[model samples]
Target: MTGAASISRLVKKSFLGAYLEDALTLFEAGSFLAVIHQPDAYALAGTAGPAAHEDLLQRFADGVIPAPHTRELAVEGVVFGWLVLDTPSHAEASALDFVARSLREIISRELLRRGLGAETLEQYREVALLQRAVGKLNGSLDVYQVAHSLLDECMATSFPADHALVLFLDDASRTYRIVQSAGSRELPYAERIAQSRLFSEVLANACWDDADGEDTLASERMVKGEIVNDLTRDPRWDVDVPEVSRMLIVPLATSRIIHGALVMASGPSSRPFGSGHLKQTTTLATVTGIAMANAHHFHQVQRILMSLIQSIATAIDSRDTLTSGHSQRVARIAHSLARAVSQDRREFPDFAFTEMELQEIFYAGLLHDVGKIGVREEVLTKATRLHPRKLELIGMRLELWGAMHQREWTDLFERLQAINSAYDVSEEDEALLYRLANKSIAIGEATIEVLSADELSEFLTPRGNLNAEEWEEIKRHPAESHRILENIPFTSHFPRILQIIVQHHERLDGSGYPAGLEGDELLLQSRILAVADVYDSLRRDRHYKKALSQEMALAILEQEGRLNKLDARVVRVLTGALESVEHAEAPEPRAFGLGSPVDHP
Candidate 1:
């Protein structure tokens, strides 16, 4: 309700009406009560006995009859109207004075009650605003994003100003940079604000005084915040803008350390910031400081974790001389492919990876072969069908056979050597190996088979260097990789890292090893890693097979995609990315190996 209407209602409910009527009856005097409402007045209550007396009361209310015997009706020394009476005897005058005093006290009490109610309502509003700001500011762990949210909450809530800035302290440079801003004035990106002596003094006073000696006054001033009512006269107004008439500067700090400062300002025409603004700004700045500190600590931990992961991957790669730097290369390629896939709207319209998810993919790529650490060094670096020691033993057995049988086994030995090192053993070579395995040489002391059962099995293998047993051992690395990684805590930020690593060797058609997981069971990150692993393996020369050209390697990948052994969309994305690289004159593809090339004989 309007203020005047509320006051009128209060006056009617008070003793003004009853007291005036009692005075008229007691003294036979004409009396009335009227309330002043700006330029005019109106009678609230009066005597009821005579029409002529009532007519005189109305004329006095209208100012037609002179108010010569008027007593001012006021509360807190401010008059609202008058209590007027016709000439009365001495006894009636004293009674009327007491009634007037009682009426004034009632009006004063009512006004005080109304003010308290308004203040309570304002407190509730402030509480609600603070609750909302807390939620918004604490929602993110990114320091830069939290800074932006801090400024946004300040301008959008009860503490709105004509200008707002969130500045962060650069520890290395010992300077403040405007990280986020909102106002009519355009702020340059990362603009450095000079710290004047007054500005530094206020900041030092507002924050914790870290001196060794105890000073009660300094301790009291710590974290109380600052309010500059007149920027024109204050030396602490370091901002170049002169039009800002007032500012509230609060340090974004926690108990541990100070991160930066928050500055909120008003233009000359805007309302000056007071203690209320300082209280609200300090509350928001405190929440922002805690959030920024958490983000800073989180990023620090991430850097340390990444460094440890890289070292482990390097150790794994270094174990096998032939595949040195393989893990690092796969990580780069997988990260690149993931970026490509994220941008391929037509192929992956609903699949967009966040920065953390992309980091997970990169980490998975780097540590995909961690299980190789558990495998024997010889098996990891084996370049031929048989190990060197076993090959040497076989050659000695052949020489003993040739001497005992009185026949030259020179051509047969050379053919056996060819079969052992060949990328693919022909059917003719397999038959020769079978014949050799069945034969034996007899001597005076003992009888020894020319080729043992295990040797024949490894020599007759049709593809790559590893035989059936070694191939089984090689396949265990994926599950082994999972076993090693599951013990570590990777579920928080990189929840999919373990899954991606274990599934990198899996295929869409259930042809791949370890679990034979098919189709939709695989993650997109796993598919990306699979493509990168195979691509890098094909492009690098291994002990058994020569490196393939970029075109040939891609052709092999496309064939595998058609066979349902790899994700087609991921393959296409890699192809597009490589084409772009070629057009851009990227450096030559480096040599790195994962293992035996995928789908190669």
Candidate 2:
């Protein structure tokens, strides 16, 4: 045997060490090589009877045999050790190195064959990152918070790395700073300056700039082998430390542009970087880049949505100067109450929607009253307890009645004058007339304070023969809101939420208003909106009434809950969220990534 044969013998020896019985049985079963189950794992002459042996011999006549890499192939009553290794493909047998390469290739092909390619794995990883970011966002989980979490995962996965830094490219479009860091890395102000310059000069310029496109590679200011690693070095590694000098800088790029970068380094004990390793690093970078971009994008989208919502809330407040802070105040209370329920580990298992979802809910609450924009101002701003036009009509009728009373009194006074008792009769009649006028004034005054919206509209409408023509008004504000929203293209994608806005006034007991939806018939968002809207209305100063204190507003809601007006559990959430909103400030979105610093009114 030559060197090749010796190598083959060594391979076979190690193979047998792991599976002696398998090799021996295959050698023994070569006699029966026909009509065997080819893929069976445990087939050999030792396991078969005489009659099956004949079938194995018949299969041996054909050129095919057991697969080379995997055995246990059955030839009726026999198995073979690699199916005789004989090949009719004379072309393949002619090359020695070709055969070795073929074997190596087979092992590498397994993952691809199983549908787990490098790209596929990377995709799965991206999805996982997206899920985490979204969860944090929904939990009102901060964007940087999610990045820190991802860094923790990375650190936990790679133990020996003494340092790590994750930077998110915020909207300044030129700057990216330390989002999360661990170990001895002294983040340099210079690096951030350089990073900004690079982003502005390279990434920002390359992306969306007419000269650069998706194919543009991000330019690193401190290029991996030089500037950055030196600045962020571990104190223990000295110049004599040739053992600890490996650096890996991988640019995280995606379909659109260069999203970010991941820098991984190790001191001496770490293996030298190789092509395979570079590919792995690049893969991770690409994934991280896409994730950062997506997280940033998702957050901005939320803020954009919130801004629109807040604008609506602000608009509602602006309409009634007295109730300027109403909706926002409600949102604050509701969110605070919700956190109270969600923060405690004993009671809060896991908030399902996450930070972003909570924000969406908060935004929706602020916009719930936007539809009231369509309501008539006279009705909304009605003061002194009576509708303006109806009060004028009442005044005219009273004047006519007073005229009739005066005529009768004058007649009685004349009759008394004739009997010389007119003065006494006139005095009694005067008193009686004064009492009737006072009684009428008291009725109008009493009803004005407690009269509800619908009741006010009814009472003011001249009733009976004395009033004007038949009076009626459509009272469903939700449907009206839906109609109004249906016309605003800015809120197109949010149709369901718009619907919730419309139906927000609905009651679970079918006693609320408008649609009167019950139980699950109402959306969770709508349920949350109901409490927030109600709270804001109560807390904010209004045209017709005074703003109640936060505590008083909450008490009103609690009472409404017992009465089965608003959902009890939802009110509980709002009550808990009260302080969160009161002291709660929306994080300046501009600070994170928006083009400018977001200013709140």
Which lDDT tens digits does candidate 2 get at residues 515-553? 667777887667667776777777665543567887898
The local distance difference test score of model 2 is 0.46
Model 2 spans with C-alpha error above 4 angstroms: 1-309, 344-351, 406-457, 460-475, 484-496, 573-577, 587-601
Residue-level lDDT of model 1, residues 109-217, one tens digit each, is 8666555544543543344344455556667878889988988887777664777888888989998877788876764422433355444665777665447664334
The C-alpha TM-scores of every prediction are: 0.46, 0.36
lDDT of each: 0.71, 0.46
Which ten-residue region of model 1 has the weakest summed lDDT?
592-601
- In model 2, where is the ten-residue run with the lowest total lDDT? 1-10
How many clashes in each structure? 0, 34
In terms of lDDT, which candidate is strongest? 1
